[model samples]
Target: MYTLSLEVVNKCNLNCSYCYLGEKKNTSMSIDTAKKAIEIAVHEVQKQYDKTLVIYFIGGEPLIAFNVIYEIVAYTKSRCMEMNLKYMFSITTNGTLLTKKIIDFFIKDKFEIKLSLDGSQEVHDLNRKDYQNVGSFLTIINKLKLLRKYEKESDKKVSYAHVVTKNNYQHFEKNFQFLIDLGAERVETGIDYYCTWNNDEMKGLGIQIVNVFALYKNQVQIEKKRIYWNLLEHYLEMYLTTCNFYACKAGLNSMFVAVNGKIYTCIELPEFQIGSIMEGLNIQRIREIAYVEDKLSESCINCKYKSICKTRGCQASNYEIHRNIYEPVEVKCRMTKVFLNLIENNFTSQQLENLKIREDR
Candidate 1:
């Protein structure tokens, strides 16, 4: 309901280890295809949701089809203006192709760009590299520097996203500090959901990430508004205003449209292909996908700590041949419990007793 994310191209230059696209054939969306998606997206915005619409440029590498993106943005803006609609732009991109022109475009248009960066140079180079085995660290760092210079020249903020992995988990604070020094106005960090490792490996990686996070929390002196544990922060922010929560929103408000116009409930379900834009962009199809109840197979469904846990059953698990639904991984679950326990310990006795009494009643 908030954003309509679509892929214009599935042709990436870099071969990231954790990429969901994973050796998938590269494909680019034609301008006709782009127009179809735009028309459907704009129509849905005008006819359905009242909130401000945001068109998210998602891709194997959105910047690969930069001209298409520019065209879509210009066309959408003009149409929205004519229709008196409110809208904005967002894109998630690897920093490899973020040239000066792209940065200038983002700055001039105030488009939100979320560049993917792992923790540090060594950590990033390990997983995010070009086909020629070249490390992308220096190139991306240079691009980031350019972005910072833009901020100095124009006094506008640029956003950065850090994907936490076992390789760089130990350097969370250091990496974050580096970004801060780069003059990034906002930053968000999260676990790499597209990890190739199996359950145990993922669990180990989760623990490593948390270990690094604890170290970061203890060591860093973050004085400004930066997002740590992005998932939990977003959940808490939403819950503070509205008393609604969910362990998963696979089919709920969020929708992902792939480059071929196939729609999905979540990015994790990219292959599921729930519908297509060629069919008039039916919101009902999305609702059906979200509302269709699948059997909950997680071992920790009964765990009291499940409510606060950030890592749980993923989209891949649902589509797997065996459908392994494990409880929230131990690392995330334990960390959530630890944080919650700290909060409860700090509460006044009277307040704690009042909460208990309310629960009893």
Candidate 2:
């Protein structure tokens, strides 16, 4: 129950209007239905979990079925190495069919590519365009500047995701210092949850992302940081943040297997309905009671970040934008008090001792 997701193919080339697998969902699964949906999700996480299993590979563009994702990562690493288990893999690709034989099969089978660059290139070609309106942001920023000038996998690392909209929130710090000068060790950025960040164009992109972190307060460099403020860094580190449906273990830690073999709980909640690695990944027979009452709303039960938030904020964007799973809406709480009031006015004291020595290495 340490994560399992495999939407092997919902088939996407590009047409991002906040895709809810809708812009012609061509669906795909068969490679013997993705090896029997990874043998019923590794036999239901080895019959109710022990640990060490992390598979992600999600899509409408998981490299559009790159050979059924290289035969489900070589048969889920040869059946989780004959059941001694332990396999980790990740993918969220939109790096325009990254090639060099898909970056040498994501550097000899160890993938962690998250790429979905949403800034600059005129704010990511105005919302990742292409349905003949063309603009895959200069073909994914010239394939992330040709994978930072052909990085022949020196122990792989390439992360970048920029969403924050309202037309790129007044150049969100010159689009995150132009993807940290396009080398991008890490850069998440987020906030454009299908538009409307308390508009006036998102309070002018929340005062231009809090005045470019108060004008690069101490020449910005938070050591490759940016998990788009994962819920304001879990309310600034453990002031409370927990999930997996508040511990009922949302079908064990996390699972999303879509693209026709159907299974979901995260892929932004794929419109609530769950269950179907052909019909037995069974979260008590998911016919979808909005993820069986883990549901929230009344603006998340009168938000104060609802007991440290997480009820449902993305099940495939809650059925394509408020088709209703109670309507919580997200824009990262309209720029989390303007990026924590510009990190408490430029966090100095030698920039918090160089941000705690770059967050302790």
Candidate 3:
């Protein structure tokens, strides 16, 4: 699988406090640039003989560049069909700009939609605010209600991507329950790696995770109900597979194309530019990013949980925190150890063995 993430626009209507983009620029992707990016991405996938191509639209707000998105999707579909390549499309949005027309288009095209929300109205309003400093919770919730209505009439499932922060860490269960109440069955949430966490906050987060895990075990293992919690699912998969590597597919089979045509290994790491759509990929830079795992810290190499640990850590976060991709974030490392211990303590040896057998098959 090859994923091509396009940054459709560099402008946003919201001034989210934890936004990685920092300052907003008044820039949007031109149709010409979009076409070239699509061509370059398609050629790369074809050259690599990838079976699947995923066109992922992202931005400060992708919906802000809806016209450009429409053009690219239409063009990419035709191009992929002509080349006999299988393709899938997806978009990550803030959910503030969702409209009936946009919802209809996504449903018709079967585009995977991920909406950014921070659970309850109060927690969401703490950071996610509009340009005028107004809370966006009500606006987003209203839009989400409309989306849920359309989703029931179509085959599409809208998933939520939540950001957990120190402000809401103590209320994790409450936040999660709020999303469930808002008609979200599939929820993807992660701690803000960039935020500083106090000891109390970390402990609270651990307790919350454990509570959620217990709930997940009861529902899935006991009641046999189908629900998706990304964090719980990831740890469960790691336990079942016993996989050694946990690196993200950023530079390996995925890339981010900026609005101005510059390319990077991942969208969050704009400083690590690999090339541009106009000049094509920089082979040496790509190779360096692909082999970044080889430059691991000695601590990681000697850690007891190195083998079974599925937390290879995000290179972008590592670079931002430690100024080196190989240097693991101490907080994340500690959290991983705690999480693994929790798993070891919760499940019996026989249950784990059964899971392995089932997964391995």
Q: What TM-score, over all chains together, does every model reach?
A: 0.78, 0.31, 0.91
For each candidate, the alpha-carbon lDDT, in order, equals: 0.63, 0.65, 0.80
Reference-based lDDT, residue 305, model 2: 46
What does candidate 3 score on TM?
0.91
Cα RMSD for candidates in order: 5.2, 19.2, 2.4
- Lowest summed-lDDT stretch of 10 residues in model 1? 237-246
Residue-by-residue lDDT tens digits, candidate 3, 1-361: 7889999999999999998888888699999988888887787787656557899999889999999899988998999999888899999999999999998888777788899998888899998999899999999878866688657867677788888887777777778878766777788987787888777877777788787767667766787766788876567666566543325657667888888889888855665788888998888887766665544578788887776665655666678788977677776777777767777898899978887787676
Better of 1 and 3 by lDDT: 3
The TM-score of candidate 1 is: 0.78
RMSD of 1: 5.2
Q: Per-residue lDDT for 1-361 in model 2, tens only?
A: 5667777777788888766566566777678877777777677667645646678887788887888888888998999899877777888888888877877777677777778887678778776876787878777766755575344553666778777666567777788778766766566666657655555776787777666554444344545343243333433332222443333244555667666676666654544545776676555544344354566765567655455344344344555577864465555544554554455555666755565565455
After superposing candidate 2, which stretches have Cα over 4 Å from the reference? Answer: 1-37, 40-75, 79-107, 115-150, 154-157, 163-168, 171-173, 180-182, 185-191, 194-196, 202-262, 265-271, 276-315, 318-321, 324-361
